[model samples]
Target chain A: MTTRTGPPAPEIRHVTVVGCGLIGTSVALALRAEGVRVTLADHDPRSLSEAVRMGAGLALAAGEPPADVVVIATPPSTVAAVLRDAQARGLGAVYTDVASTKGRILSSAELTGCDMSTYVPGHPMAGREVSGTGAARADLFAGRKWALCPGPATALLAALTVTELAALCGAQVCLLSPYAHDRAVAAVSHAPLVLSAALAARFAYTREGADVLALTGRGLYDVTRVAGSPPELWIDILEHNAEAVADMLEQVVDDLAAVGAALREADGSARWGVVADLLVRGNLGRELIVDAYARRAPAEGVELEAA
Target chain B: MTTRTGPPAPEIRHVTVVGCGLIGTSVALALRAEGVRVTLADHDPRSLSEAVRMGAGLALAAGEPPADVVVIATPPSTVAAVLRDAQARGLGAVYTDVASTKGRILSSAELTGCDMSTYVPGHPMAGREVSGTGAARADLFAGRKWALCPGPATALLAALTVTELAALCGAQVCLLSPYAHDRAVAAVSHAPLVLSAALAARFAYTREGADVLALTGRGLYDVTRVAGSPPELWIDILEHNAEAVADMLEQVVDDLAAVGAALREADGSARWGVVADLLVRGNLGRELIVDAYARRAPAEGVELEAA
Candidate 1:
């Protein structure tokens, strides 16, 4: 273990992005736009060629000069393997992975006995319906939140390097423990996925669903649009974040029971009040979350419009 | 009982829309656009005048004038009372309503002994986030579904008049039993309201919600957008459709429990598979729903270069 402590002299001049997929290409483009030297690498030659065509980076050879910073933007399941391989080959001075769930990545690193100090785990809360390097845009991360989950041995220099990387991408960098990060994401992101899917399934089984669809409105669109997300990707994410996600699902069930009871009593006022209370509280909570992450424009008006 | 059967002739030359709110004004405007002479009436004189200004009608009247059709677009709790007043005053030859819930309206009509032959209950499944006559758009119901729940002894002429009204508004007319209408809507529309609110409430109770908001994405926005709906109106709807809404909520709770169990198991493959299955089926179900409605232009792809 390198016993070197404190911040290292800022020497990150050339950055390398591996995997050349959606997030990887986006980071490369963002860094390149800021006049940073960027190199691209990917096992898929087609994706590497696509990233190059998109001006993400200059294609680098296997034994090329090492970059100052390296970013791995592979899928969550493959993140640890890529990091271990890259570090063993001495790809860069410091490295990080931009995966959605962090706890699993940290655990993988620990189990593999990778150099924790040189590796920072992060997630940039940005994406669109489309995927791949061809769909990447440098502005993808603008005004978005990029979370950094640094292990105990993470050097201050490595942390600063990652912060500067986020700044270059026009992102607001926030810090969180890996456990907290997983739990919070499970509440807002993973739970909603399952809920939306369940709603869709229920509609499919209903007899009048066809007739109902003829009258479908924006309300249904807003609620179930995410149900169209890639199933395989979601399955992987849920599996990795099962513990925290399950807890959130329990809370949702409890609330649903209250709604059911209010309906059974035919208490219109209570039923409406129950739903209204949840919506109002959600609006307020969402506002706070957006503000802290600086994800939205400053709240200028009465934010609670619906509930 | 006027046992008027078979296809009723189109005798509704002049139509009057009472309660100049969003639905009422939109209906009036749509009819007027079809070159039908429309008369506007409302308890609020200002609202009445505003409807006329928006070309909803030629005049604002205190009492029902000579007309063939009358549309009552008041709140659910007030539907019975409004119908009683309209019928007592002989508003028109054929009468209908534009309330969200239908069972209560039908019940109210029965209790008041409103002329069943002349009364045809209906609801236009169309609206926006904004409210009032000023927010009313002429094409609000264009290519949308309009459901009609007619009672026994209803004259064939009244049904034809209502169908013509739906066509004039560019909507597809559907016939359903009042119970079915309430039950279907509770599953699709009312339940979403409760679910959205519940999600918001859960976020509000979290200590890290503020932090979480900073990391929010489009996923949260799409899911909780409806949680901002008007509380008073929702309360009225939930109360009116309490039984149907309650049953749907129970089913949702059961689904949530099953999902929770899947998550708690050490092997989350089954749970993950369940979620994935739901999403896949939901995608197909939602697509069918959208297709059953009018088709909108697909999103155009724009070439996004690095910033």
Candidate 2:
């Protein structure tokens, strides 16, 4: 493994984002707002054309020169194959991706014999409940965490260039291993999605019908906000990070089962302590997350290495 | 069961709100904005003073005449006792409360021999992550549902006056039995709080420390948003509605265990459908909630009875 880390980020003038989904289009819009030349590409012609029409960037033309950085913004399952093809065609001088899961993609890239020297695996910790290019906004990544997992074969120059790309889009960069990225996101993102979905699914089985939802307050609405996300998109996300997501989810199940049993007890006085303990821990965890979000903006352009 | 529904709401000239926490303060503020005379009361001197300073209203003075409506805005566990005490003092011509759970409070009120004829149990489907008067706002209940659970003994005038109270706060009124209200909120509010708490508590066990929370996006943040609520308050809510909340929590655990088992399987292809099915159900449920919220405004002043 390479013990060396990259220097400060270099100035980035041109970027090529190879998908026109929400994250890809948002990146293009942010780069465009920074006066950076951004070339957009997508397998779906409609999405590419719509993104281009929205002033995101120009569509890639035949024989266009390689850009300084190429962002593989495709779905997790396709990232490896896309990286392989992009590298074969010399799409850019350096390569990175915006997939939420990293370990599997990294393994796939290696198995497919893609050049790791040019690839800096990345994931921007940002998204809305909605998806698609239509929901793209230039400020999507502003004040967000952009995680970079550079393997041993990754060149220092490639990692630095991708860091510059994240900075240009107004994001903070954090460095960690591929394993850590998958586990962290499973804790923070994937597992939460599953739990939200599980909670929301109960609503469908309610005998009281949809009118029963009238009693719902802001609390339930907030907890299930992401349950409205497209199922197909989340299916891919959950499948790719299944083991890590499953691990966290299993722990949550244990917590719920214990709390449920405590509530079901006839002698409720002693059992309330069990329920209260979990709620108190929840308060601490939630405070930590809020504090982390508040601390992010001031730390922009500063790279945080995983402990 | 009372088949006798109230007629059109009457004009509410003055309101006496007996608590000065977030919901009560917000109610006071909203009423004050509508030119209604508001007299506030709280056992906590600081909260009462804070509400008054925030222009919520005057403090309740001894020998003051009865107002048109009295709102018991205390915690769920104390609502019955407060209602009994307020009635003994002839606090108002009609009475209501803003507790989140209704069935147990209703039973407790009956057991305490409170004057049910002058009382209506109400729950406004509105709140914030933070508590106390400091977080109160006039628009807290605007465009939200206010549920009134009027038992057989509740006077038509009492229910109508409380409906007017809700109207002045810009809330839509819905009618359901105490049992239905408890069950609905268990499915929508109280149970979701437990699930969110269960999910968030896992963060406390992360080996990666608080910095790992930096990986969180808006999805996870939204899912855990209400997990930061005061634990003591939630403990009371869960206890008051224990049976209903436990029922829903158990159902959720079953769904989660099923999905978790599916994810843990060595052969993942067959089990993906299990996860995907729950996700699809979640989408439908979330859509129902969003649609319910959107439909709340134009249906203002129309009371929907539980079927």
DockQ for every model comes to 0.37, 0.67
CAPRI tier of model 2: medium
Q: Which structure among the candidates has the greatest lDDT?
A: 2
Over the stretch B1-307, how does candidate 1's per-residue lDDT look in tens digits? 2344455537557898888999999999898888889988888888999998898996645664657888999878888888888888887888899888898888878888888888899888888755788989889987677788887768777888887788788776678778878887886788876777667667676666666665677777777767666666777777788888888778777777877887788773445666666667777766665565444222222111110
Regions of candidate 1 where Cα sits further than 4 Å from its true position: A1-13, A35-37, A43-46, A58-60, A205-208, A266-307, B1-13, B32-37, B44-59, B205-207, B267-271, B290-307
In angstroms, how far off is B55's CA in candidate 1? Answer: 5.2
Q: Can you tell me the DockQ of model 1? A: 0.37
Model 2: pairs clashing at backbone N, Cα or C within 3 Å? none
The residue-by-residue lDDT of candidate 2 on B27-58, one tens digit each, is 99999999999999999999999999999999
Superposed model 2: Cα runs more than 4 Å off = A1-13, A205-207, A298-306, B1-11, B205-207, B298-306
Name the best candidate (by DockQ): 2
Fnat: each model in turn? 0.61, 0.77
TM-score of 2: 0.92
Which 10-residue window in model 2 chain A sums to the lowest lDDT? A1-10
